[model samples]
Target: MPVRRADAPEPERRDLDVRGTSVRMLSGGAGPDLVFLHGAGGAGRWLEFQARLAERFHVRCPSHPGHGGSPAAEWIEHISDLAFHYLDLLDTLRLERVHLVGASFGGWIAAEVAVMASHRLASLTLIDPVGIKVDGWIYPFLFGMDIPEIVQTVFHNPMAALALAPPDQSVDTLAFQYRQGAAIARVSWNPYLYDPLLRRRLARITTPTLLCWGAHDRLAPVEPCAQAWVKEVPGARLRVFADSGHVPHVEEPAAVAAAIAEFCGGIR
Candidate 1:
């Protein structure tokens, strides 16, 4: 037996076909549209943070291709492809000037989207975003480690991660998780996660930006990397979540949700 999700909205999951790829998206609540792009581990299921956001804005969380229920778009071999695909996704969904929120890997995609097309965005919020490469900073062995090792490295509070996890772990669930990892490896392996040209292009993104980071992030060092985002991206503000890990939303759901709500409220 396996459980699905905890704190996720009771809404049924739906899929939309965009350019031959099934983009699995979950929509809930009302008000202005707010799109959530997940990180490398994949947006498993809507978390308490998403539910909280849905209270104030219409939240749309879509699983990246080859992750969750979203089928793989084999042609997508790079982060640039994902950026382009999201552009198409916006057109297909008929969404206009929506607020964008991305976490981890998704934050990189959000930055790419803003760089490629800022006209379609009203605001941008990144949580522990990873796109810029800093000299002398190296990420831990991602694909080389087991789940426990990665978990310990990813979250500051291991107890929170364990509590948030699905109580019933099934074979299918493990397989799905593995698939998401493989998909991440495919796109991120060559460049090793960060786009060589991204830092230079941050200046082109004109949308209001907010950078949120877990103080205990081990993957992307906080010093030069997160610091670099604030320095390079004009008008971008940084907020650090104390005692949180890479996924602050999971570790500190209420605080992260409140930060997002407040940020979105001031967007003009």
Candidate 2:
């Protein structure tokens, strides 16, 4: 069901019907499953950093419903809907446990998954994530900004940011992206940045968790919003990328990949 993008270079892709929604996933290498979830407006292709980790772990990156080539689900309303869908994906794939890594909104989903199904996760990693609203800290609304403005705020290198913008997108594609962004904001906008109740639930997660933050992030600033995770999530470790912003994997792939490999490798 998952069709490979004609422009994509030889990446193995497949689709699984989870709760009646077709979920597109890209997979490579072999061994323990390591799933990567991208943030808003991102797709499975965003998991290029996981390619190196694939040599030791079968990396599974799924295009969240309504983003990339996946069809939007009418029943899905909240972020938890996406989280539960991922849990269903694991069940459909017969994956008993896996190492999960997510960015931004995907990170929020990963947190929800860990809280809901601890037995299914071997470990968890969140990068510049947004799921909890910290008092006194104001987080920016990324969806409200234009594409170029959003990129400028999230990436340190202007060239790298330029490379991420969809070059061949048609008017219809751009319109659809905006619509999807609006839908995501509608469900996730409450508390302005994150759900107020999410932080309270972090203490219950038993899996070894790592929180990676971009020191220069403007979208989800580090000092308070990002660092707070370490205090709330028991035994959670934090790694800050000095020269990076919101999307560290894109801004500094090697460092992001190395941190992930080191953390996941140490997990029992």
Q: Pick the candidate with the highest TM-score.
A: 1
Give the clashing pairs for model 1.
none
- Name the best candidate (by lDDT): 1
Model 2 stretches with alpha carbons more than 4 Å out = 1-9
lDDT of 1: 0.82
Model-by-model lDDT, in order? 0.82, 0.79
What TM-score does prediction 2 earn?
0.91
| Separate clash counts for every candidate | 0, 0
Minimum summed lDDT over a 10-residue window in model 1 is located at 1-10
In candidate 1, clashing pairs total 0
Candidate 1 per-residue lDDT over residues 1-268, each given as its tens digit: 1122465557447888887888888888788889999886556466677788888889888889988735678889889899998888898899978899999889999999999998899899999988778777877777888778888888898876764454457887777777777888887876787899998999998999989899999888678678989998889989999978888877887788889889878874
What is the per-residue lDDT of model 2 for residues 1-268, given as tens digits with 9 covering 90 to 100?
1122344345588988887889888888777789998887567573356666566678888888877746778778877788899999998889899999999888998998988887889999998888887767777766577767887777766566643566468997787676667657766876565777788998889999988888888878887887788888889999999878888877776678789888988975
TM-score of each model, in listed order: 0.92, 0.91
Question: What's the lDDT for residue 254 in model 1?
Answer: 79
